[model samples]
Target chain A: MNTKELVEQIYKKKSFLCIGLDVDLNKVPKHLLKLDDPIFEFNKAIIDATQHLAVAYKPNIAFYEAYGIKGWKSLEKTITYLNTNYPEVFTIADAKRGDIGNTSTMYAKAFFEDLQFDSITVAPYMGKDSVEPFLSFEDKHTILLALTSNQGAFDFQTKKIEGKELYKNVIEISKSYHNAQNLMYVVGATKAEYLSEIRGIIPDSFLLVPGVGAQGGNLQEVCKYGINDQVGLLINSSRGIIYASDAEDYAQAAANKALELQKQMEEILLFKK
Target chain B: MNTKELVEQIYKKKSFLCIGLDVDLNKVPKHLLKLDDPIFEFNKAIIDATQHLAVAYKPNIAFYEAYGIKGWKSLEKTITYLNTNYPEVFTIADAKRGDIGNTSTMYAKAFFEDLQFDSITVAPYMGKDSVEPFLSFEDKHTILLALTSNQGAFDFQTKKIEGKELYKNVIEISKSYHNAQNLMYVVGATKAEYLSEIRGIIPDSFLLVPGVGAQGGNLQEVCKYGINDQVGLLINSSRGIIYASDAEDYAQAAANKALELQKQMEEILLFKK
Candidate 1:
């Protein structure tokens, strides 16, 4: 799906929201454990509760892969559930997978073909061959990790390459690659201050942002700098939303948290309009 | 096992051979496809055939993961076969997973604890917090992707961060994180020319060299520049070995390929001493 179409839907719905399904087994509602598949149970409730308010749902694959086969099945169930019930919601496999050319092609098939995720997160360390294969999918999107919110982000991301932050250079040079429009980036909300600068470099591209809620990133600041003419942001809150409470009513609590973010996002979109 | 002890074993065996099990479903033998679990059958035969000739057996997760639940089960069976039958043979998940702090911890658990891989490949783009989680596991190794052999590897890797190549800086800085001693790097053999430069930064650490066979990496060039005093190289060949022949003789062809690499590696190890 073209990002402009997503933005158009966002404006029509008056919400610029994305709910992150980073379901952790230990942290999920204890009552849900009684179900045969706790991960799918937890995700279904959250998706049912918040689907109307969100434009997308980002599922971090590590959470599912942790439980091994059972976890992956739960992931498949969750995606199938979404497709069957909430097909309008965009799906992102937050799997930071990158490798040699042939290997990367298999990964593209894993997410895009086997799992049917709308987008997949990729690391740009291996350069064009590793990432271009992912971007080649005419209908799919590749979310490259540019500047993250982690402490080690400063380790090499900000390193100056020819008088520019390595990340800045990455965005500039990555633009030159063929089929660049399919490439978005991950700019963490905790590092929202860099959004103004990031937007200045690549103004039109969408950003799949994490670190908004439990990480204590102020949503307003991220919207202020990260939003574009099309309202280009998918703010993800994992712990803050999905783990809102461990009580039996955790789903509703998650819905409440999602509603809070959705309301704020609506206001931002209104302001932009 | 300590890195030095592992190196000693490789030296005594006169081989730094790591047979790569990047199994392609289509390349699997037709006879095995009749088995209840074809991929597992294929992997078991290959592992059994070449376990002695190789010091390590790296099963790239993508090939198996592309098959969905069956693929994951195949991966589990592959690792289980490796651990149960040949425990001394080091196992690598070849899953380049890295994310934020808590997420990274879960990924570390997925591969290292849950699956019990001796090592897991990690992408270093998210910085130290993402990578440190993987390194924190006791005795388990985390092989970070360094200079890869693909065209895109030049995209962000060779970009000078503060006037030094990003790959070099990643090695230099990652060397200082907690439990960094358990760290290794994935330096593709196709990029063998830069191996000496990589070794200069982290001379004593192990390098998991891929891209040798089907990817056109020269083994001689890799050994000449990449090998250190410790004989610390785990050169991997996937398609060249595992998929050498797609017929019933596939595993036998795999054994021959592994033997060829081992023979060459033995000569290199002797020449170095």
Candidate 2:
């Protein structure tokens, strides 16, 4: 999925919220857990209840993968459900995978061709060779990890190199790679103040902003700095939305949380215009 | 697997070769394509033929993933075959997966717990949050991509910021992360000249060296500069070894290639001791 289409989807829906399905099997309700594929069942309920409130549905691949092939199958089922039921909602495989050239090709095939995720999150440490392989796939988005939300990001990402921060240099040098047109990035909501500087580097690319809600990053703070003319931010809420309730009304509670995010994003969209 | 155990296996077998299964289905023997799972069939045959000659097997995850669930299952089967038959041979899930703190936890589960891979390749873009998650897994090795064989590696990996190359900084910074003892690195054999410099930075960590065969990287030169007291190198040869022939004799041909590498490694061991 290209930046323009993602932007269009957000504008059309008047929402920039990307609902994150970072589900944990042990935490899932016992009723659903009884099923053959409890993870997929829970995801199906969440997707059904909250699809209208989301412009994108981001599934952190690790959660499903923890269940082994069962988890991978659930991931497959979840994507299949999204494709079949809510085709309009953009799908992000929150799979931060990066490797060598040949290996990246296979990852591209898994996410783009096999599993059919609209976008796959990538770690850009291996440089352009690891990244370009993902970018080479037509219209498939490769979301680079730029400035992450966690505290440890300050360790190396924000480290002062010559006169510049490594994170800043990463963003600048990444722009020079071929076919980087489909690239977006993860610039955390916690680090919202840097949006202006980050935007200057990659003005048009959408940013997958996490660290809102459960992470204590304010939506207003993120929207203030992150929202571009295209509403260029996918502010994600994973634990805050998916685990809003463990009761029978879990899906409904998820919808409520998702709706709150959608409402906030709608206001941000209004201000951006 | 732990470093000492891996070293002992290498010494006992008289080989330091980790045959890379960067297999593409289209590149495999045509006759095998008729099987229900050609990829697994090809891998099983190769493993059976060469397990005695090689102390380790590195299956690049991308190749299996390209085929989707089938590809992943093939990987599981390949690992299962190795574990059941040749329990001592180190198994590497050549999946270079690294992400933000929360997400990296999931990725660690995906490969280490779910798939039962002994080792996984990781990207170090988001610094500690991304890499620390993979390292947290007890006893499992996380091979971070340091220097690679491809042309595009020079794009960002070699970019100088503070008079130090990005790869150097990555290795130095990564060394400080918690539970870093299990960390190895992917240093391309083609860049053998930098092997000594890399060894200087990381004198202890095993270097998983690729680009050794068809990519024209010199094995002898890599050994000269990269080898440590422990023979701290897992020299990988993929296409040139496994696909040495396209006929039914493909597995035997792989064995021949592996034996050739084992013979060289044996000679190198003599020089070391």
Candidate 3:
């Protein structure tokens, strides 16, 4: 899906919430464990329950990869299901993959062509050549890691390079990449104070913010500085929503949690209007 | 495998030559393409032919991940083959993966536990929390990307951070991680001039050096500054070794190419002695 369509969906659903499918079997409901593919089942249930309250589903690739071939199978099934059942809801691979030029091309093919994710998160440490391969793909988005939500983001990202923060350098440099219009960015909601400055660098680009609720990032603070005229912010909630309740009503419980966030997003959008 | 064991294997084999199994179907021999699992078959042939010459095998994960499920299956079979048959040889999953603390644990599990690689390459952009989890794994090495072989390395890696290069800061900061002993680093052969300074920082840590032949890195030049008492370098040549020929003699051709590098490595070890 294109940026225009994503914005359309956000307005249509009255939400810019992106549910994170970082499914770990240990955390899922005990009853779902008996199923043939528990991971896919859990994701299916969550998507069904909260698809309306969200415009995107971001799957943390590490969770699926930890399970090996079985995990890859589940991932394939999940992507296929999302594309077939609800194509309108954007899909983010959240793979955080980047490599040398040729190798990065292989990764782009894996996530964008084969798995068919609308976008995949990429690390910017390898610099231009490592990231540009993903940008070359028409219509497919590449969410570059500008300033992550994690504590580690301070390690190298916030450090000064040429008298400017590395994250800002990344945002500034990436704008010049080939077909850079397809570029989006991963900015942590935990660092909401940094958003206005980040917005100053790339005011129009979408930022997939992943830190709220469980990570102690306030939604109001994030929206206060994050949202643009097109509402270019995807506030992701994983553990706070998915693992809400492990009982049979786990899906409903997840929906309730999502409803709370969606209602707040709705109010924010209305107030902005 | 531990550092001691890896060093022992390097000395015993008289070659720290790391064969990169970056098997792209388009580049492989036509005959192998007829096989059910061409990727695995190609890898097995190459491993069988060069097992005695090379001390380690580094399969670039992006190559496998490109093929999706079947590719993962091929990777599984190839690794299983390497472990079972050539148990003495060290394995490196050139995945170049890193994430937040919890997610890093999942990636460490995927490569170290699930994939059972002796070492896995990780990107250091996220800093301490993103990398320490990989270090926590006993006997499993975390090869951090310090200076990559690609041109993009010059983009941010060489940039001064607080009057010191970011790559140097990465090496310095990573040393203070949880289990610093388990940390190796990826210092590309293309950047041989940076080796002495890198060696000054982490003399004992193993450096997986790619860009030997295909990317125009000199093994002799690399050995002059990069080698330690244990000959702390795994010189990787992917296309120059693996894709030596696309005819029926592909395996033999690959072995011949690996032997040339192995011979060069042997000379380096002998000269060092």
Candidate 4:
């Protein structure tokens, strides 16, 4: 989906929330396990319950990959269902993939062409050529890692490079690449204060902010500093929303959690207006 | 495979040549396309032909992942073939993967538990927690990206951080993580001059050196500076060796290319001995 369409969806839904499908068998409802494809079934139920509450869905690729071929099949099914049923919602493959040019092209093909995700997370460690392949795809987004939520983010990302944080340099340098317009960024909500500094670098680019609920990032603080004219922020919530309950009303409980976020987002959008 | 087994294999084969199974349908022989699983058929043929010449095989995961489910199935089959037939040859999943702690654990399970590769490449962008889970696995090696061969390596890796190169800091810092003994590094062959400086930091850890023939890296130069007491270098050749020919005798031609590398490796090991 184009930036305009994504913005329109945010306005239409009153939320820029992106639900994370980081499914783990141990975390899902016990009753779902009896189903033939529990992962897909769990995702299907969650989507059914909360598709309207969010404008995007980011499926962490590792969750599916851990299950092997069976996991891959479930991923394929989940994506197909999303595309078929709710084509308006933007889909992001939280895969964190990047490599040398030719190898990266294959990855672009894997996520963009084959699995058909609207966007994929890319690690900027490999630099220009590693990231440009994904950017080259028409209408597809490449969410580059800026400042992640993990404690590990401080280890290298925030380190001073040329007297500025490496991530700041990443945001600055990446802008001059082949198709910089297609780029979005992964800026963790835990570092909500940094978002103001980050916005100064790439004011227009959408930032996929994870770490809102389970990771203890304040949504109000994130929106206070992260909001743009086009609602250029995709706040993601995973475990706190999806694993809200393990009973038969698991999907309903997920919707309730999603509704809470969506309601907060609605107020944030109202304040912006 | 343990460190001792890997070192023994390098000595036994007299070659640390790592053949890259980066299969592309367009590059393989036309006849192979007739098979039910062309990628697997090609990999099988190449493995059958060159199992004796090379001490290791590094299958670039992107090539297989590009084809979607079929690609993953081919990857499963290729790794299965390698483990079943040539159990002695060390396998590296050239999947440069790393994520949050829990997500990273899932990736470890994907490549190490399900895929069963001896080692897997990891990007250091996420730092310690992202890397430790992979290293936690017994006997499994994590080949961290330090100084990549691509032009992009100069983009951030060579930049100054605390008066030292970022990649240098990566090497120095990674050593302090848990199971640092299980860590290896990916140092591009293109920067052979930097290998001397890298060796000064961690002399014992293995270095998986790519960019040999097609990327124009010289094998002799990489060995001159990068080699350790354990013959701690796995020189990878992908396009130059795997896609040696596009005709009916493609596998045979690939073997011939691999033989040339194995011969060069043997000479390097002989001098070391």
C-alpha lDDT of all candidate models, in order: 0.86, 0.85, 0.92, 0.94
Q: State the local distance difference test value for candidate 1.
A: 0.86
Models sorted by DockQ, best on top: 4, 3, 1, 2
lDDT by residue (tens digit), candidate 1, A17-124 = 778888887788778888898888889888888887788888989988988999899999998899788667778999999887788999999999988888999988
Q: Write the per-residue lDDT of candidate 3 for residues A1-273, one digit (tens) a residue.
A: 899999999999999999999999999999999999999999999999999999999999999999999999999999999999999999999898999999999999999999999999999888899999999888899999989888889989999998999899889999999899999999988999999999898899999999898888999999899889999999999999999999999999999999999999999999999
lDDT of 3 by residue, B191-256 (tens): 899999999999888899999998989999899999999888888888998888999898899999
Candidate 2's TM-score reads 0.96
Candidate 1: which docking quality band? high
Model with the higher TM-score, candidate 1 or 2 = 1
State the weakest 10-residue window (summed lDDT) of model 2 chain B: B152-161
iRMS per model, in Å, is: 1.1, 2.2, 0.8, 0.6
Query: Which residue pairs clash within candidate 4?
Result: none
- lDDT tens string, model 2, A94-158? 88888767778878889998898999998777677878888888878888888888886786677
Worst 10 residues of 2 chain A by lDDT: A152-161
Give the per-residue Cα lDDT of candidate 3 at A203.
90
Ranking by lDDT: 4, 3, 1, 2
Question: Once superposed on the true structure, which residue ranges of model 3 sit more than 4 Å away at CA?
Answer: none
In the range B54-159, model 4's lDDT, one tens digit per residue, is 9889999999889988989999999999999999999999999999999999999999999999999999998999999999999999999999999998889999
- Runs in model 2 lying further than 4 Å from the true structure: A160-162
Position A139, candidate 1: lDDT? 73
